[model samples]
Target: MTWKLGLYALAATVAAAPALAQDAKTLAIVVKGLDNPFFEQINLGCQKWLADNPGSEYECLYTGPASSADEAGEVQIVDDLISAGVAAIAISPSNAPAMANRIRQMAPSLPIMTIDADFLEADRDLRKTYLGTDNYLMGVKMAEEAAKLKPEGGSVCLQLGNVAADNINARAQGFRDTASGEKGIERLTGQKGWTEVEGCPVFTNDQADLANQQMSDVFTANPDLDAFILIGGWAQFAPQAYAQVTDQVMDKLKSKDLIIIAGDTLPPQTQAFRDGRSHAQVGQRPFEMGLRAPDVMLQLLKGETVEDPLYTGLDVCNQDDPGFCKDN
Candidate 1:
């Protein structure tokens, strides 16, 4: 109508346009420890989802402890991304509860998705959904397989990457619960929670090496250890070291005698399982975590409901049966 009113309207529209553009901007993925294949799977998933959605893009930033035990490292990474002003953050948290308040403080409205390890506290406010394996079930799967390998389970040792991680903790719980449920199995005390966070041991770039050494030390210390269940990446190295040490101790003992059942089938782990150096493993579809996590985040951003608390299916890799144990 009036020239003054028209000018005001034009300025208002221009101001609103930038806000809208900012709303349509790409996402940010902040993960813990880029060094691990597990996080690599999440990266792959996020990138593939962004590629499929032509207009949307993503920026991925990773930080974590020198070892798998460092949960704090993951929280610091989330903080860094918030400072950088990200749209959304997809993380496989080392410590879900510990990182919750920090992320909430940083980006309260920013859509957060947890892959692999999860945080229930974050679900109430800061985060939208979690995508990963049913870690407790994964633990149960490991124990169930351990039973098959050693019907009379004597001593089971757990070698997990990060004890602070809820997922790893849940899996460990599941393993212990399942093992206890069984009539014959007796859980051992070789489970050492290692991480890259503060206070945890430092071997981030060299987790495989640490895993190898740890396994060597565990078996060497306890000759009575009947079964070994090492979850996550350390599972890969456990058998190699077990093979080496066990071979040195008793040449007649086959690798199967120890009843090794590990979790999260990476390339190395899958290869090891396939080669029969290890017994069986619980495989988390990590690639799918990377692929599906972004979609879940997008859904949350659009105010859509995600059916599963944990997305991305999981399965057991039983080397005894070649099909279940194959690599992705």
Candidate 2:
């Protein structure tokens, strides 16, 4: 071949090398569920990372179940990703224990990381690192926000979602501990600091309809209920919850007799807060979690150590200062 042609051929090969290498390696992002905008934000974060890192030699694959409670479905998706020979996996599990077990089963073969939620402390060795909010701190923030509204303290119901998940349990306990410590805020049930309302916390399984029903039942049973501390924004995300809230709690809200605080500032929740339906929301960095997970996974794959239980900070959004929630 001519000298000039040979040089051109070598340059072409060099330019194609990175693309070929990237096409071989795959990074799978498995989240809890795509139904919620939080997870959708996570997906977007992953995409943004991929776009920002132009030289990264890995193909990103994002997937999740339709519902948050589908542990088996999430497990199956991970299994599929593993079988597809993905170089690494980042997942936000529905059931932390089951996810830990699955990760252990595939250990030393694929690098697995957690996002948005984490495995139990005992199972920390299973995943490379956890990239998400500090649930306990998030709960504390929620309680602080509640105190701002009702400084004198009053009766409040706690709406929890999927008590089995690590994040859910942590936030519930954090809120309980903080609220209990507030002498002015009185818990009306015998379920200790954690489950103090309606005898026990209402678990919504991350379903909006179930959350609405539980909220309604609690409201009916305790007509004098002063506030609702939602550990998860389940009802706000569901369309059915709109009517239920309007019918059962709107009058009380308008009268300033009832206060509602929730976590996660998605479009629906932000709109509700703007409309004066909810008092405040605890904002989680789902997009940041998504953006960070892949970076951590890449580090793990390179045999570089990363911080375990990495936190993606929290923010409180209300009508006055909406923060990022205002974007919705």
Candidate 3:
């Protein structure tokens, strides 16, 4: 039999089904949104796993909110997935705190884990384990890369997704701590020759268009801004706008007047790096996360004590180097 993978939103996949239908056990992979290419790679990973293990009874049901900004919608989808009685669940929460609260309220009997992002440390026990990148280290790599291009620290901006996202926050903190040359500093403000410039640390809420506009606005406000660290690849997701904006700053980039170290090496983002729009990229392996999630959750279902926080490592590359995507 030929099996196909399709994007299943909550309503179409879960609500339409009878509660806990017994036809085939479901392994649900919930991401922050349906729009991001990063998440699409994850879906592809899950599909690959299914293809490899043909004739398996488990069905990989990948779903998420229509938009990355819809934090509440993601939580609702998780709740509905639970109610639909999926055999196991792997979620990447957009808003970690709210999702943790929902999990506590419902207290699902079936096993649940996190992918790409996890609940905050205070709420760590709520999930079986987390499978994703070492976000803080990912940020540290970005900082290190930026420092290489411009040894003298200068005014900068941090491009992030939702303010409440645990993964994005961790990455931001890592960048700040490493860039400031001080460990555990709460915020970067004139520390060790580095200061996150005023009107900086702009939050894009994971929208590609908004991210590009934010970059343009920040650059406009601070023409002398030395560097930018994109904790998420929002702007680069839209390659054309990214190219246009980078074209404007190409002179600075060439002169080392401005350095950009963005996250993720998806096709478009990598092409942007090749075009010299971004100086470096520190990316997470969402495909690996998706591939490992099903088997990990299955082990949890069998009452096995799996390792918590299965880190899927990083892929660092610069304009001069192609990173791990070179293999593909």
Tell me, by TM-score, which candidate is best: 3
Model 1, 1-328: lDDT tens per residue?
1112222333444343222233454455555565565665555555445445554444333345454555677677668767876667777676666788787676777777777767764354666777778887887888788777766556656776654577776777677767666422334333222111122221223266677676667667766666666766553644566456445435323556565676766666667766556677677776666666666666777888877576566666675575555633
Clashing pairs in 2: none
Candidate 2 segments exceeding 4 Å error: 1-22, 182-195, 319-327
Clash totals, every prediction: 14, 0, 0
Candidate 1 stretches greater than 4 Å from native: 1-24, 57-70, 120-125, 182-206, 235-255, 324-328
Among the numbered candidates, top lDDT falls to: 3
Error of 2 at 45 (Å): 1.0
Candidate 3, which segments miss by more than 4 Å at Cα? 1-22, 325-328
Model 2 quality (TM-score): 0.85
In order of appearance, the predictions have TM-scores of 0.76, 0.85, 0.91
RMSD of 3: 5.3
lDDT value for candidate 3? 0.83
> Taking the tens digit of each residue's C-alpha lDDT, what string does model 2 give over 111-145?
88888888889987778888888998998888788
